[model samples]
Target chain A: MTTMPETVVPDTGPADVPPVPSGGVRWALVDGWTLTRRAVAHWVRDPAPVVFSLVFGVLIVLMFGYLFGGAMRVPDGGEYREFLMPGMFTMTMLFGVGHTAQAVTADLDRGVIDRFRAMPMSSAAVLIGRAVADLLLSAVSLAVMVGVGLLVGWAATGSAGEFAAAIGLILLLRFALSWVGVYLGLVLTGPSAVFGAQTLEFPVAFLSSALVATGTMPAWLGVIADWNPLSSTATATRDLFGNPGVGGEAWVTQNAVLMAVVWPVALLLVFFPLSVHAFRGLRG
Target chain B: MGASGDAVVVAGLRKRYGGKNGGGLDGVDLVVPHGTVCGLLGPNGAGKTTTVRILATLLRFDSGRALVAGFDVAERPDQVRARIGLVGQNPAVDEVLSGRRNLVLFGRLHHLGAAAARARAGDLLDRFGLSDAADKPVKHYSGGMRRRLDLAASMILSPAVLFLDEPTVGLDPRGRAEVWQAVRELVGRGTTVLLTTQHLDEADQLATRIALLDTGKVVAEGAPGELKARLGGDRVEFVVRDRSRVADAARAVARLGTAEPTADPDDRRVGVPVAAGATALVEAVRLLDAAGVAVDDLALRRPTLDEVFLHLTGRPADRVEVRK
Candidate 1:
């Protein structure tokens, strides 16, 4: 290539940047909060998806509580609606993975993720903010579901402490699964992947003990269901909620609370790093 | 922050992919002095976007040294990112968020306080002529408006260097012109711009210097006029009525210009660079008439970027394979 004579450099001074420490934990928190606000603002501007997801959750409850409740029985012969409530809460949390993935995929498709990656803000803040925002939405959805549950003749018979603990377990499951969503959003390709994820989540949600007793499943399937992370949370939340679908003979089911705590933590340990790696490796 | 006067310095950059997909850069070297636009002009898959992506600290290059805003792209991407801004092919702003909201969000991410961010957002909206639509969601804004918002988002920190990768690829003619006007304004404010485009006119209109890329390499680098000049003055092109007479026409026209004439049998056209524009046209016409070769079209035209691409890369610009 032919070279040209060097042109004169202009006399423009440095960019007008204020002196703000842009490193370490404080900036990370600031950046994370900023991105969280961005995600929340999107929810505010386009409330359809959020509204649809919440309505869909409620529809599931109504469909099962009234329409399907007569045909099903809890293993310990408790009210089917009571047994179903804790399961529904756990399912609501689990479905958050789909929401998280959809949001992430939308950002990626729109090249918003690329812009965020190119910025000087905290690298982890993108995923952190997304996870936190999704958690907030999940918390809202859980509260609405709890209200619907109570209206449908279900009660949290446990003490206030156990009730809080059940909520914590539910949110923890959501917090953990959100990383899976982040990783999937980063790695999956095409528009179909987002919708495809929604379809795939059905089996993951249904095969667990969220709506029925794992003991009712085939013996081989019951073992698998009993060990499912969703099942652990469902059983553990039922135990905490003092709802009566917690009966299972498998060691994993008997140790639901420990497994409930262990599953999400394990998922976090596995997926947090994976999500970070995926975020850092993003390229087109 | 650079010790040298250049805002961007790329040395022998190389990035290779696993397969034969031709998006890999061989060894690209570039220098863009401060406060000037350096256009990376090429056809699709010419590695233009790859270079910009690396310099913007968004991609990790396999090998090479790149310094943007005085920070090494590989070793200190954060520093480079802090000083540089990027407008990718897509608008990248949230479709659901209002234009003002998008800008303020970017401002806060840039570490501006709430009041300062709002003030800056207002200023940018005014500067970009987006104030009327500032409170409207970006999805409702026109293509030009969305691009303007994208530009405003990138300018939140008044970055020293801006990397625009095919910034006007999908816009209509009017939208393209709007973005070009916006870019000119930014350039006047002393932001060094590295713009990549497949549009020759876009490069011609905006870049003070253009680096012609082909097959992931800098095939030619100079000002637009200089690149055109490198093709050797004006050319008189003519089409023959009879395809068989194209050779005869070239044989006649060859004597009119000092250099040999090139003929296309398919188009029955012959073109040759000449020392004198109008005189060469008249002489060529007379010679072709004398040779009994009927002419279809004749004109003296400056070398186009398409010709420049052909002259430098031995192929038309658009024929290059798409890069991954």
Candidate 2:
């Protein structure tokens, strides 16, 4: 294309920006905190989705607690609501993993990740910030589930210490699952990933002992259900919360709490670096 | 920092995507002096976006050097990023967040203190005429408002150099004009800008210097006026009313120009480049009348960028097929 040549346009804005001061840990933390707050602000400004997810999780709990409660019989003759609470709590934490995928993918598709990468801030801050925010939300969501469990006549007969330990295990799983979210977000970009995660949710949750007793199932299916990673946390929570349904000769049942901690730790070891590597690869 | 005064300098930049994809740079070279708007003009697959991506440190090059704001893009990318701002082809701001919140979020990510980020966000919102809509979520914003908010987000640090890649790719005429005015204000503020666009008129209106890229190469580079002037004097175009007399009319139109007249069988028209302007027009009309060639329309027009693109690249500018 051709046109007239104007005189050289002058620079009038500020020039010679001072070099960005470099500090490793402090800057990363600060950047991460800022991004976390940004995510929180997003939730606050548009709470519809957040509220919907919370209500939806509770709705599932209520449906299973009341509607399906009469049909499900625990092997130990305990209230189905009591047995279902631990299973549902574990499922809720695993379900939070899907949110991580959705959030990460949304950021990637919207190019927010690109903007963050272009900045000179800490590279891990964006992913870490997202995980931290989601973890905090998971805690709130778990509290709501626990509250719903109490209203439905579900109680932990264990001590306060055991209850605290059970909550900790559930949240640790949530934390690990969030990194899975981060990895999936980067791997499967765009709006479709949200629906994909939603579609995979029920199958993943049901394939374990979250809502049904492994002892009531066929031998092969029961063994598989007992060994599912989510079963570690569900069995551990049942034990820690003084609920029913924990009978197996395998070491996984004998050491439910230990597996609960180990499972998420193993997942974190795998997904944390993988997610960071994916984040780093975006610059390419 | 670059060894030269140019805010941006690139040499022998090369990249390849391998296989049938086939869209990357090949031995590209460019220079934009400090504080001037250099229009990177090209078609869809001209590698204009790739060049900007390399300079912005968004994509790594296989070979060669790119310097932005005096810092080498590959070696000192962080420094380059601190000094440069990029507005990509699509609007990247968050739709769920308010316009003000989006700018503030970017400011915070850049490591500005909370108060400082807020102040800058407010300042930018006002500067870009977004104060009226600052409190509303970006989803409520128009195409133009979103583009302006994107500009505001990129300006969070008042970057020394700003790279706008097709800033107005899908806006209406009024929106385009609004963005053009905003760009003028940005240049007036002394921020050096590099604008890449497919719209020739956009480049014509904004760029002080034009770099014509085609198929991953800098095919031509100069001031827009210089490029047009280099094409030589005006051209005489006329269509014959009677299709059968086109050859007779071409002979008539040929005698009055500096070179042989070219005829288009489809339009039944003929065009000739001539050194003489009005005299050539009168001479062509007289010659055509004497030959009894019925004429429908005739005129002498200056060379537009459309003709220049055709003259240099041998095709229209918009007919490029972008490859993934």
Candidate 3:
């Protein structure tokens, strides 16, 4: 007892060490799905934020639809409420990028991401699950904005199929924006950085035909607005919804539907892989 | 334990941050016998967390072989992660979720079905004394409860080896004891633990073997009592009332130890660093009496691990105060 008094126990330890199979593609897919479910589970526990994001978009829509709709002149005697629906939907999707960024950074700072890293799950599951969950949340937020638009007499006069396509465009924009969120979250690792990243959303959305017609702006500014991806989606969504939108002679407005699909797809092609690559280098 | 039962083994482990001479491990080696707790004792920045990180497969070491549960950490990280659980220096469980959900989330990640994950979550909640707070958000729990939940989250699968880096750091005494109790329960169930701590008392209380690390290297490795014995049993110290008599007492006690006794002028004390139990205690009084150095008070104090660290490294283990 005088020397080395601590009791040392002997054990038969677990030998359930999984083999490092060169490829576990199916396992990775299953694991990625499970992690996506986990990300969805967060919504169940904290639905307020989910609800608040929806309501925040609704509040913005209401503000623009009524508070400013009467004073603001709609192009060609078109209802301002009708002109604002597509822009609000695009703005709602853009705002979701900030939410995703903040959530990702919070997980990183709190070691939640570290927990997943230490596990034997697929590496891509972390970002993929988060992106999927954020996409779903953005869809809900867009739906809330649409409900607000309908209440204010903003009619989608197009066919049911056109409405579905418009929704698909909004969600596609959300998916691309979420990749930007994931990249910024892994790289910045600070709440303030999320706010800084979100600051870009306003300039990008406002410079376009989102809130107003690009024709109302100067020629140079209007040209830049027409070139914006948000403008493409907003103009395309308005055309598809049969809402009042700028009928420009320019190629971008004329081909709004194609550019709407092309822009978000291009963004996904660039940022989705970029964010995945960024996640791989996060340890550095 | 048999050689095959060593749950964790590191050989020639080296890592550097930035370029060179940045805070990281440098050619460190360690071994933990199965089912026994190995306390990696060191001050802050002593590479404890770094070593644990490498073993847990969350880090890439510059050059080394780290084996966990008999799987090479680098070549077979998936194999290693499948068997090992890491309770990091910070709690990693989600605060927004209830303790129960947190456990189930980990269980599901480990590939347990929903029914099995729910059952395991229940069992862990009971084992960790978190059943009462299982349904409450973790943000509502106390620090101790959160740590217990963190431990529970890691043990969802009864991992073969668990790495807890400074688990009790920043915990209150009650909280620390609760965590220690939980750790003890895990160890009793045949889980090997690699615990990094700065508290000497904590190592004494929980570790089967203690590896004292300094500047990313194991300075000493042994049982607590064995390390204490290295300083030669007990410390014999006395203070003289008269300042003038301090020098005479120091010279008298200098002959007692293998090395010269150290004198503290501020306390008017001279202490013999090494003494073989009570026999030297008796001899020290006789010698001081013979040297005409009257002592105000004299006693033989058992040397603590802190003293052993000071004796071995010529520096006190900074931040080594009994934290809990």
Candidate 4:
């Protein structure tokens, strides 16, 4: 306190000593887990969003499966509930984009992302943690939707191995969409803007074969629906579960399993890098 | 790497956002020596936050040399991050997590072990007076408590330098006082802090040295008293009973100081900067009485930082002032 701060020119002290350096993939993994715990803590503190997600999925299934089952027509003439279950599963994965974008943008608006960037932790930690957390929650909602489907007399007549494969494909789409959400979150400005981005999910889900067969639609509309990534996943899952509404002549629908794998893989390839680039460009 | 003893050294720093909102630095230079509180005082949109962000390694500047804690911000940002903590204008803590949990969470991110992080969180909760509400979610904490929690989080690693970008922007009086006290405590522990504030009095109260930043560049830099002294040592002002006598009073007071006296006819006030203190005030009073000027009010006071800022930047720092 006695010495003039500008004129002191003192020797190096403890404050000048830097902390031990952190590096490599190991640190990134550790930091990612730490941030994942942060997301889990938020879920523990406020479970409303998680519960709402589950209830919403079940509500959609009930409204489509039972309410319109008799009136709705399956392409191959089967039970409407059976046709609706796989579409509902694919819809669950598609809706995850909204959640991912909202969470990312909310953190950005609140300055939490800036704080994470300022820390000495690995840069990839924030996005990785977000993806993992969203996937975990998505899995929970998927299971609940599956249970609701079973309650409505929807069954997977395929082998258990095929059933697991269907689940994997659904999650793969979700995982790819999470990156898309992350990119959208990093770019969108405010809550209203994020809401606007989330609203786009409705058109995407409805236009695809998530609720009805593309065969019943107009020819042009059917062509668009068959090419939709959501339709590909839904069609592939229907094939795996041995459910109804599997009739389609288009190349994408005919090779549904291959398209299911290609679509999410393509989405990941495009959006994963895009999300990272957007996150880094935030400083600029 | 920096050979200088300064905690932060920024020279010729320039950044352009290339948009309608052009709030970026042109050519700014600043030097904050180790273990001192340097207040970057400015009005809104003066690039204070930009400078702090660049120095904190959270922003990229166009071209400049910025070194924090002996590491260049551009070349060795990771090293700078290892040695610095930042409390942005917004409270960045997790809203759903408790204050203690938030601190512990930050500690783990800083790479502290589980037990170490918990112990550090406990210590910070006690130090920041957040123990009573440690278990409660941060969303439940009041504005002051949240700001305090933010301060506590920034201190988790006890970094060499701390960048505070308007730490008390929207806080109430009590909240502002609490933040000021916490900042003073940080300085007492020998932490070098570069604090940006829109309040001139805040700079006066907390800064060892104050840098007047305006329109993206530092217009003036010195100790608070030195800055006040630069506007001339002291001022003796008198409000006359009759507006007609304002000039008469000004003329009488003119002979007492080296500078010419300024008379405000609307307010009937005459003021002049003076080198001497009580004797100059007494001398002006006797001269005014001899000149038949009836005085309504008068006082001899040192120039406030607001006046100093007004003189340097051609504008007041802020319209509001805190009474000394």
Candidate 5:
């Protein structure tokens, strides 16, 4: 037989095929779904952390409802559980931000993020996918805490539509805060920095109206609480549940709702790009 | 790109870390042919991995023009990434997920639909001999098994070109062999591979062509045999019967050959370089006998790749000492 050619032909099979009709947004959604499902599956395998996180929420609710409920009366025939539920919901969303930082740090340490950076997927997909995943985990955590509250005699007097709207509002706030976690995770160098950032979560949560009504706090402190994003979510959830409104002005009512929506949107605007920039700067 | 085309081309690739004296790659140039395995041979700090990272689109080059599969890495990184797969020194699989799940995750990331992703994961598990542990958490995998899984993960996208940076660095001999077998199978399927390693033997075995990197430059490059042949001589080594006659034997052997004879004082051996065939061997023996120098043992050998590396780098291949 004749000698073979010096160079054989390469196999350029279907990778060179036509591009898919999917746009960047569709790709992001699919990637986000995949990432969220994977995160949930990981939680299924290790449920201890989920339980541990819920216990913290339960403790906060029980301590405030029993120890302080006798001294602080709920107007309009509302029970302490109703007042405590909204705060717990806000606390859950805020605490879930720490999980985002933890997950991103894990991905960074394991070099999974680097692997994604080298892939053909959209650059923004990595961070958005992670945020979406964290949001889903936050939803599950919120559901469990709410279910436990109901079992402990908490009830919502509002219509089902209002409750659904409250849930949507809580998710929007969590989704925004998730970007803060994503941004912090990308900017921090190691796990120790992540833990340090996590320490700030508890103080931020407690400083808001999560544990006590803003009206009972010092005048100056109450002003700060009214402007806090957690306060907005907590107040909105309390209003939807037909619980007694903590004394605040008309500005506080509109500002809380605006802050709740604007905080995540603003965070997405700033931290979203920051996360992408950090991802790009990883090797540097 | 065609097999006859250039699979990867780099010109003036430069990168520097942000500390004093922390440059990684400096003014590097390289080209890899399609459908061929190019071994990037270097010691720990020789910038081999840096070069591979730039080509694979995992790290950016401060200033350079790098084209992988005909796409500029800097200008069109996603396109470059689409055509190449990188199996870095560390495995990038999710430890919490099962081996099959990890594979399926990557498959989906490559845009393969659910059913196709599952089917591909099953096939890869079998191919990598991970079928038994397919459903087990990769956190429980041994180093070698994890490496196999990492290599298998890169193939899910069916990339046209593959980059392996020290793929067998921490593997046992058997694991290395298994990886070699898997690599050969990939080559048989027409995947172009660029593998970097500090192991000389690995380069000799796996590379169709090798580039020896020193400091920040490629000092020598060619096929192993061509590099060896360039050293120019069949090596002749023999032990002299008497230590005192070593001087005389050296002189006699030098006289019989065009090259100089070297004497090892501690081992009582004299080695001389000669051309092919027994003529020079017989002449050296006769000259030694005339000088009353007895030979205890004699043998002629061809130059090894180690000798080629030593001759080119002006230092022993295994004992390369990098100055900080």
Candidate 6:
């Protein structure tokens, strides 16, 4: 047999060439937008979770407004439906944490997350996309629940500007809570841990004044409720909806809107890094 | 050894989990030249996947240096990631979404525009022979179909370097051939492929060079022909009809060949290794016939990758345990 000379091929090709970029952050943003859009498309196809979350929020409002509204008196002069609307909004945000974990955990189990990690996109984009998609779904759920509440005798006496402020607060809270879900979804080992992480929402919601006024509760429990983050959001949402304020010291000083933003910001600050760290650890 | 430039260079790569006692990667060193398919051959727990993960920037190595396409894996992971496409052992396709949607999703993540992503998705689907199933949810596809789509997903960006971690482990023979064809096509297009596989034939068929890893270390590395040549000569075996004629057959075979004949007492079979050529077999048949021993069956076979693996690893390939 004739032996042909082996040709030595070049190791570096035009494909190995790197793009010249002035800023890495610009590439990250571009990649992040793509990831966000992909997540949105995923939500569009499988919308049951989104619908379930919204309907669940509406049921909670219905049960509380007509069944428990008369039994519990609002310190402010407004119908129970109006008093509970803000709390229902907070519940909507809280309910989203579970769905976020479920979606993320499913992705992890399916190896989709690992595939993304191997890509050239910004590492932070994965979590950011998840948060954005969940935030949008939560906003839609809030709008639907509010519309349903209005049909069930809930009325907002606040001006259009105040209504906007309440909606903004709801969005901010959801954005922050989405990060919490993203963090938990990455850190938790499996689906069971996701369920366990969701169990925290019940105590957090009940400990706050979302369902009742802190004044009527025992002094010790009232102290806990006053410090609860959800209570701060509920108080701020109530004021924006034009409901009777809890009055002096208890109402004005609560500053729920500011606290609502702070809680999520703090959560994102701590958990965002934690989630990234966990994702980095996934390789091990 | 030739000092070939490293398309993929890894040195002293070490990774451990939990503690020192825990199972993880050990110090692994690999050098893959450009435009070559280097097969990382090993059984389970050989740390082949871990090495690939580090090279792909999906996992960090605890120590040692890893450079892919001239960028440090740990320090400049994004740059390394930009150069590589990883098709892992498991199918990573989104089952709820259609195959077309899955491709689009990956394309978007690669930062391709909407129109470009759609175009690439269609091209990849057609290339992998999945165009018919593109609109169906991945859950509706068979295992082989899903694997093909998963591979297509990795190729969306047309990366310069590709890492395939057991890409055809569970595929049927037909599916395996299709994947092999796709890989050969990719290589023909000038993509450098670093693949890990348990199948010896796969390595022999596709890899320009094979690295046999055992217990997280390279026991042998060479071209398939070189490794097989090192294992010695061809194998010749034949069965005898009468159990009483086994020794007579062995003695007769020993007369024609300098090598000793090994007789299997239970089956009355004899086997011997001989130098390359049919002359040794012809001489053995003549001697056996002269001794009046009837042969039940006779066959001459060349060294297979399985034999090379057994010689290097000291255990059969099927005995190795793979982690799910």
Candidate number with greatest DockQ: 4
lDDT of each: 0.86, 0.84, 0.82, 0.86, 0.78, 0.78
Query: What would the per-residue lDDT of candidate 2 be over residues A225-274, giving only the tens digit for each residue?
Result: 77877999999999889998757777777787888899899999999899
Off by over 4 Å in 4: A1-23, B1-3, B241-245, B285-297, B319-324
Give the 10-residue window scoring lowest on summed lDDT in candidate 2 chain A. A1-10
lDDT by residue for model 4 over A140-253, one digit each (tens)? 898998999999999999999999999999999999999999888888888788899888888999899988888888999989988999999999999999998658889999
Better of 4 and 5 by TM-score: 4
Q: What is the TM-score of each candidate against the true structure?
A: 0.90, 0.90, 0.89, 0.93, 0.88, 0.91
Runs of candidate 3 exceeding 4 Å displacement:
A1-29, A36-41, A71-77, B1-3, B19-22, B239-255, B285-298, B319-324
Model 3, A1-284: lDDT tens digits are 01111433222221342433422666566666776777777888778888888778878988888898888776756888898889888988888878888888988888877778888777777888888888877777777777888888989999999999999998988898888888888888589877888898888888998998888899999999999899999999998998877878899989999999999899889887788777756655
Query: What DockQ, between 0 and 1, does each candidate earn?
Result: 0.35, 0.36, 0.36, 0.39, 0.28, 0.35
List the lowest-lDDT window of 10 residues for candidate 6 chain A. A1-10
What value does the lDDT take at residue A134 in candidate 2?
A: 95
Q: Which of candidates 2 and 6 reaches a greater TM-score?
A: 6
Over 4 Å off in model 2, which ranges? A1-17, A21-23, A217-224, B1-3, B238-256, B263-270, B276-300, B322-324
lDDT of 1 at B272: 87
Please provide, for model 2 over B1-324, each residue's C-alpha lDDT reduced to its tens digit, 9 standing for 90 to 100.
Answer: 345779999898887765643447878889999889999998887889988888888888889888898888898888888988888876789898899889878877777777877878887777777878889999998888888888878887778789999999899876787688778888887778999999999999999999998888898999998888768768899998888888889988787777888898788988898888999889888898899998877999778887789889999997878575
Q: Model 3 chain B: which ten-residue window has the lowest total lDDT?
A: B315-324
Model 2 RMSD to the real structure? 4.2
Instruction: Find the 10 residues in a row with the least total lDDT in model 6 chain B.
Output: B16-25
The order of the candidates by TM-score, greatest first, is 4, 6, 1, 2, 3, 5
Local distance difference test, candidate 4 = 0.86
